[model samples]
Target: MTGDQLLIFLAGIVGGALRVGVPFLFVSLGECLTEKAGRINLGLEGVLVLSAMVAFGGSYLSGSPWIGVLAAAVAGALLATLHGLLCSLPRVNDIATGIALMLLGMGLAFYLGKPLIQPQAAQLPAIPLGFWSDSAAVRAALQINALLPIGLLLAVAMWWAFASTRAGLLVRMAGDSAHATRALGYSVSGIRIAATAGGGLIAGLGGASLTLFYPGSWNEGISSGQGLIAVALVIFARWSPLRCVGAALLFGGAGAIGPALQSVGIGWGYHLFNIVPYVLTLLILVITCRPGVIVPGSPTELSSNK
Candidate 1:
């Protein structure tokens, strides 16, 4: 490939990393908080889908993208709360509850989003950073999403809170040892429920970004399993909030390979390139999940350990 083509491809990947990584970043950070509280909510896929629809619908009705984002967060929190409540019951598995909720969320979204399929809602504004470059491709690549910085700041905030707050200590204690948490006079279930709800709220923003910024649309197929993949991403990051940022950008870059190549007039193996992110996910999981090898930061009560 020519130097100009190579530069364009790289630029596209970088831009895509910032763009696509916004959702992955939010979702992974949310899952990290949830898992840190001794509970796993795989229903994030459901949360993501439902929020996307709600966000779009709200934007269309209210003529305000911000309100749509708020609606999405509320919807996501409600669904996540239901998952927490069900799992709190005796003998109810968190993973199983998540699976059910995932299906439920998707079904509800599909049924409710039929009308949204044709509507054009207001989208979040983009920050243009490409004026320095004369090339149209470069200009397009530099149009970063406004939510990206917000997600980054949120990640930093979460990491700090997890490392140095009273609530953070309680969450860690509950995840590591339920008995210890109980001895400290804390309700383990309450902590987990709160964390799950908060996580869902954050994940909802990711859904908002998906519909209101990047893809800029409301559709059943918009998510494309990003919510599910985020579970693996959290694992890959070893539950570190800061690492989640890097992992998300990496996943975004992997996802951009196909489109980047195609943009440069290299269409061969486009389909194969499209699967890079998934392939990378499997590879990361395989490498990290070794028999008899415990993940250092993983919650003790996580179902994977049990």
Candidate 2:
């Protein structure tokens, strides 16, 4: 490749990173919050699928992308809330409940999304910062959706909250030891239920971003386990919201490798390129899972690190 061609390839990578990272950032942040409350919701994959369906259907029906987002959030929260209730019950295993919820979410999404398969909905508008750029390459590179900045800002805000705020202290205490939180006159289950619900809301929003912003359409296959990947990202991030953003971007960039390569007329190994993100995730898991490796900023109560 010539110098200009190499630059173009580099630019494509940057654009791809933003395109891919937005969903990861949102989902990982959600998972980070949920995990901090000492519960794991593996049903996030189902939540994403269901949220995407609801967001698209709601937007298509209401003629507003924002409404769809709200609908998706509500759907996600409902699912998470259900999971929270089930897991809180005596003799109910959280993991089993998560699996059941995942199935339920997928079934519901598929059943309700049947009518929305072909109907076109209003898509979210992208902020065209790239339009101001004189260079075509620069313009293309900057033509990302607005959600990227929003997700990053939220990550920073969440990090600060978890580290500095009184509520953060309480949440950390509750996650680390229910007994400790109870001794402090706090309701541990109640706090966890709230956290899980909030996590669901964010995850649902992430699904909306996928349908209304990135791909700009609602389809059954819109999400290919991105929600599950976000769970992995939370572990990789050590439950830090800020680190989740970085990890999300990395994963997103990895996910974009195939498309980016194809865009530049490099398609010899395109099929293999699709596996890059998953491969990278596995490598990260191996490295991060070392015995006695300190997860310096993780919530003390999280089971993944323990």
Candidate 3:
């Protein structure tokens, strides 16, 4: 391949990492927060699909993508909050409740999103960063997702909070030892529900980014199982919010492999390349979660719960 084509392929991967990985970053961060509180909600797939629909529909109706993002966050929080509440009930299993929530979320989205399939909604604006270069391919590759900085800031905030904040300590304590939390007179369930809802709110933004920024559309297959993949992503990151950022970009880069290959006329294994992210997820899970191996920085209650 020519050097120019190689540069284009590399640029495509970098661009995909930013554009496609934004959703992963948001979702993984959300999941990390929820797990830190010692609660697990696996219904994030439903959250993504439903919020994507709501975001698109809201943008289409209001002529504002920001308004659509707000709607998506609200919808995601509601669904996640429901999961939190249900799991609070006696004898309720978090995993089982999460699965049910997933089904409900998808069902609702499909029913409500029927009309949104054909409508063109306002999309989130992009910030061009490749103006320094004259090449069209480089310019396109460097257009930053408007929401990328927000996700980065959130990661920094979460990491700092976990390290220095009183509330962060309390959440970590609750996850590590319910007894310790109760001894301090805090309601375990209350903290967990709050975390789960907050996490859902963050995950909702991931959904908004998917529809309003990257692919910039609403569809049944838009999420493409990103929600479910996020669970493994959280584990792979070992619960660190900052690490989640790196992991997300890695997944994004992996996902970009197919298009990157095509960009350079190496399209014979396009289908195989598309599965790279999933394959990477499996490898990460196996490596980090091997039998009898204790992953560093794992939440105690979360491990026991699983």
lDDT of each: 0.90, 0.82, 0.91
TM-score of the candidate numbered 1? 0.97
Segments of candidate 1 deviating more than 4 angstroms? 303-306
Model 2 alpha-carbon drift over 4 Å, by segment: 132-141, 290-296, 304-306
Alpha carbon lDDT at 184, candidate 1: 81
lDDT of 3 at 101: 93
lDDT of 3 at 62: 99
On residues 1-306, what C-alpha lDDT tens digit does candidate 2 reach at each position?
Answer: 766666667767777778878888888888888878888888888888899899899899999988998999999999989988887787877777888998899999999889888888987777665675466875666568766777888899889988899887777787888789999899888888888888888889888888888887877788888888887798788788988878888888887778767766788888898898888777777877678775565666664422
Q: Which segments of candidate 3 are over 4 A away from where they belong?
A: none
Residues forming the 10-long window of minimal summed lDDT in candidate 1: 297-306
Best by lDDT: 3
Q: Give candidate 3's error at residue 2 in angstroms.
A: 0.9
Candidate achieving higher lDDT, 2 or 3: 3
Backbone clash pairs for candidate 3 read none
